[model samples]
Target: MQTTISLEIQRYRPEQESEPVYQSYEVPLRKDWVILDALNYIKDNLDGSLSYRWSCRMGVCGSCGMMANGTPVLTCATFLETYAPGPIRVEPLINFPVIRDLIIDMSEFITKLKQMKPWIVREEEQPLSDGEYLQTPDQLTEYKQYSMCINCMLCYAACPIVGLEPGFLGPAAIALAQRYNFDNRDQGKKQRTEILKEDNGIYECTFVGECSIVCPKSVDPAGAIQRYKVAAAAEWWKSLLLPWGNR
Candidate 1:
């Protein structure tokens, strides 16, 4: 059976126009084909001028994230059958400035990630003679879920907080921060609390639950942020209850 896939794609040509607009393309597609495949077909056969990003079609690389039918998803993982009743409206992820076509600029997210110190900091001055940092099964389970983030920025795309307040560190970075903060081998939670507890930190999250819903990886970023909030609040209470505890 021949299927016609209708795509209303967002477009911007810097040399020709000042603003971006939507352009339609109808292509014969296989029902089994993924949205990314149809996008590739359009780029190859219909419009060579179209621009987007994709790599490692297995969904691990996360380079192909776009608004598929108004939802933020990895194009490689989104099947045409998922939205088969009618036309699929494709656009760049919301709450971000469009660079061109399906591409949205992520410089702001990347820069914020660098400021949070997302990696583990070692306390020992000497090299590890133990070869590897040991972790209990429960300890691994604690942060293992948060560590699965692919940095796809889908949660950021789904985040209304980041859109409204640019200072908000957003989901992915906060999730990453939690990943390290929860790690058993890490001893930097005190230092790391500054970033996670600041104005744009966990407080910025209104518990909209959108971040957890749109997450493709099943990473509960909202939970991670909330866990940190509870911890920070308890620490605040501790400081008030016993001044010498923090001192």
Candidate 2:
């Protein structure tokens, strides 16, 4: 017997709709199909109006993230059989404003990422003899786990605080910042901390930890936020004692 799957998608078309709404579709499914494949089926066969983002269907691109069956799962990684024998709910990742359908306005997330200066800052000029900055395996291990972030923003979507506060730096960006901060080769932690102390910096997170739970790449953004908080708190205390501490 052939199986038909029910897909309930959340639709938002900013050009025409005042609010987003859910639209359901019955799709013919193969047992091995992934959620993204089902979505493509809808787009290819049923509804051309459905909108979402996807690149590198293999899941490395991190563009296909969405809330599937109520949890934030990369659509490419979430197989249909997991939510099968029944209907499934597909919606845009939460916390950001929906641009249209499952494609949210990631501008907010991207802006914060750039604002964090998520890169290594060289403190000293490279010496001719020293060559490139060397990272020992242990040093690499210290932050290698965090560096796996694909910038999928699932952590941001899962974070309720980010949902409540649009200005918050959110998860993925903070994790990326933490990645550089923890790197032994990095020396700009102090300068970056200045910006981190702003209104939407580390203080914005209430530590609910939903970001870590929903992260698809296993990047522990909550832990990174906590570690950054420790550093920030120390810096704050140091500022109280020394006027130039944060400067």
User: Who wins the TM-score comparison?
Assistant: 1
Model 2 residue runs over 4 Å out of place are 127-130, 241-247
Poorest 10 consecutive residues by lDDT, candidate 2: 238-247
Q: Which lDDT tens digits does candidate 1 get at residues 1-247?
A: 4478788888887777798888998877677788888889999999999999999989798888888877899889988877775588888888888888788899988998887688887686446675777789999999999888898889988988988998999888888888988897887777778777888888999988888988888889998888888999998898899998754
Itemize residue pairs with steric clashes in candidate 2.
none
* Span of 10 residues, lowest total lDDT, candidate 1: 121-130
lDDT of 2: 0.86
Model number with the top lDDT:
2
Q: Give me the runs in candidate 1 sitting further than 4 Å from their true place.
A: none
Clashes of each: 0, 0
The lDDT for every candidate, in the order shown, is 0.85, 0.86
Relative to the true structure, candidate 1 reaches a TM of: 0.95
- C-alpha displacement of 8 in model 1, angstroms? 0.6
Query: How well is each residue in 169-216 modelled by candidate 2, as lDDT tens digits?
Result: 888888888888889988878777788877888988989998898887
